[model samples]
Target: MTDYETIVYVERESVARLMVTALRAHGFSPREILDGGLPGIGTGLTGKGLAIAVPASEARDAQPLAEALLKDMVGK
Candidate 1:
């Protein structure tokens, strides 16, 4: 809870929103997520890409979910 780490970068706007929502449903914190696709932003998750953050300790669990989401989105 001290700090969150940016664990993955998702390029699609829709996918990024889904990732943040799904991660919360899966028990991650809203505060821990950074949706790069958020409107009206200037930097970071803005134009760079949809970047997501999670507790460093939770990265192990986050990895698979992130991968699966990205895989599913990319495959479509």
Candidate 2:
């Protein structure tokens, strides 16, 4: 099996959620990681930001799109 690696890290949970949805719509298996673990209630309040991760094998392809989405969201 392949390992998973974070492709993008965003400070806002909203952006992280959007990234997960966008990545999923593109057929990539994306997951949200909070403080190095799966997210739960009160997690986002820690102030440590969140991450969007995908399989290491797909990281190269997903990184650009993830970064682009993040940049776009931050612009608005």
**Winning candidate number (lDDT):** 2
lDDT (CA) per prediction: 0.68, 0.77
Clashes of each: 1, 0
TM-score of each: 0.66, 0.74
lDDT of 1 by residue, 3-51 (tens): 6677677766566777878888898753443434446553444566656
For candidate 2, write residues 1-76 as lDDT tens digits: 7689989778866678888999989989986444444556323555655767899988999999988888889873
Tell me how candidate 2 scores on lDDT: 0.77
Specify the highest-TM-score model's number: 2
Give the Cα-based TM-score of candidate 1 against the true structure: 0.66
List candidate 1 stretches off by more than 4 Å. Answer: 30-48
